[model samples]
Target: MVVVRGALVLSLVALLLGLSAGPATAQGPKPTIVLVHGAFADSSGWRDVAANLRSEGYPVQTFDNPLRSPAYDSGQLEKQLATISGPIVLVGHSYGGFVITNTHDPDVRANVYIAAFAPASGEFVQGLLNPITYPGSRLLPPALQLKLVENDPTGIGGRNIDGYIARPYFRDIFAQDVSPAVAADMFAHQKSAALVANLEPSGAPSWATVPSWYLISTQDRVIPPALQRFMSSRAAPGRTAAVDASHASLVSRPADVTAIVLAAATAVQR
Candidate 1:
């Protein structure tokens, strides 16, 4: 199933480049693509991108972020980062960008931000929520809030979220790159509540030190493309690439996202 999708997406990418899907077998490095999903979603959301990346010969590992507290997820990520023997490229989406940036190990060869939040020192991920009014934050049902509170003390994290409220209110953080079907799937698979409390800012911002790349989803509904650009600028990545997709650009336009990740990885290799 994914092979067909990969072939199609890759072909489209080739066409965009004014080239055919030539016989050229692009050999990518062996380093793994460690994917960290954002709030309201789990690792499965990365399945589509992972499959396409594998087709390009890149090893990928999508983590099931506890979605509990940022600190806890960081611990989990640290444990995973310990197991990989080769160099690694850390990728994050939305709030997951905070997770990747905050929990980064000195060993990470590169970092990739896909319309994700990359906060700096002493900045909490939830601090960005300041723009959201208290009543607005309460847009989530109380029942849902309780569920998220259970998984993450900060009232964040869970995949069981679904309903009309999500569609009209929550769907746009991602750009128009993703199809309705894919957006629906992501909403269904989103983690309930990711703890924003006790979520400290990045200890060692990867953008400041690591070879980093940023993929901006111009049409993102959630994080606002403007905010993404501001954050990327602060991080000072090696390069920045723009895509006309949603927040879930990795899923909606995996080829472009993959290219950005590959570029980051290639720089690390150099």
Candidate 2:
């Protein structure tokens, strides 16, 4: 009787160990992070952020938006989201914000907006940028200004180059937290699309239903700081932080952006 009891106890222990070391336990679910890049930018813009997220054990992927019409872009993004089998965290930058807002999937765990747009229902990018037209815009170096204008008519007209330079206009607008080298790299690689100009308004806002967190760049030059605040106020009233950087807070302040995303991911598990 004593031997039989001892044998039973040992068997129970072995069973428990096997369960704990099961194949299911060995292969854990991979956390998915889908990054959406904004206008005048591409997936390359999130290169640093994506690398940082990966170093920390995340399975990160970025959607290369054509920057076409908003609906067209959103449709493409949704197709990408469909491929993700598990819960996902969607991160959007600049005009990419509108894309996330429009393509938000119910399966997504959360939405993270980094110095990016968070348009409301029935609102478009123009609606957000038009309301905050400020006084004399920042000044840019004459040569650089001419480059921006000459190569891109979308830039401040032929005459506004100086005003476009002095104030850290475009660079500050997108990537304030990043280094000069990174920011310059971002600018050089920047690609503007005519479709971006035709992006339509958003129909249903993802933030209204999904958990959202916003990282507002206080020193932003492109999408005025006030405008970012307003967007956050309406879209993510409770989950917002003011970061002391320019527009590209994700690149400049990668840790903060990652923290916000990590917290959101944690909540999804609950």
Candidate 3:
């Protein structure tokens, strides 16, 4: 009887210890952060942001997002997310937002939108920039340069027109806050997004079911600040922040972007 009682007491003591421990005891390791870049840009644009996340001990991975259709890009991302066994924080910039939003990854702890598109079901990227719908956007036909993709190497259907920011207006529309030297470099490395990518109807947004956070760029010209406010509010995100930045907030304001992403990480960490 004494032996049994002692065993029960020990079990009780262990239970008490666990109950007294902080949230960290129940929390898993730091989540892997996956950043997806949108149209007209590539993964290299996330170097500074990824570096900041890495410094905080996060396992950071940046996607070389195919400027293909949203569903296709989401499928591409799924292949990478499959390798991660733990929690994940998905961060998207610009067109990258549509890609992340289309994901249904169960391990995604949070979706963070950095001056990105958080579109609704059946919404097209091009429609969002219509001044009649959400004014102040400089993404009209005049600001874009459409070129034919001869072979459609990314499998976005052959001979599709790819939309690129016009050379003269690239800096002003995309990264107004970035230095001229850096902006010029960014422009030179631009990736033209397939026209179908903008025209394709986005799948159901993960934001509808998953927790989300948004960092609105007040000085954004690519996506109007007002539209950012509307979309973030529509998502009913758990957290939202604003920065005095252009459309390339993730590049120009890496620290701010990192902070918001960190907030999402910390929330799920507990």
Model 1 alpha-carbon drift over 4 Å, by segment: 1-29, 129-177, 195-199
How many steric clashes does model 2 contain? 21
Q: What is the lDDT of residue 202 in candidate 3?
A: 87
Residues 110-181, model 3: lDDT tens digits: 999999999999998888877887899887677888888788766545567888998889999999999999
lDDT of 1 by residue, 122-235 (tens): 777556545443112323343234331333233334332222225554455443456677778877876654334225555666667776677888877666667777788777
Candidate 2 runs further than 4 Å off = 1-30, 131-173, 176-179, 195-199
Model 1: weakest 10-residue lDDT segment is 134-143
What's model 2's TM-score? Answer: 0.73
Please give, for residues 1-270, the per-residue lDDT of candidate 2 as tens digits.
001121233233224322121121124354599998876667886766677667656789999976655777788999988988888888888878888888867788688888788887777765666743632123224412322224433334521121112224556555656668877877776655443333467878888888787878788766778888878887766667777876767667666566566545444554
The number of the candidate with the highest lDDT is 3
| Top candidate (TM-score) | 3
> Residue 107 error for model 3, in Å?
1.2
Whole-model lDDT values for every prediction: 0.66, 0.66, 0.82
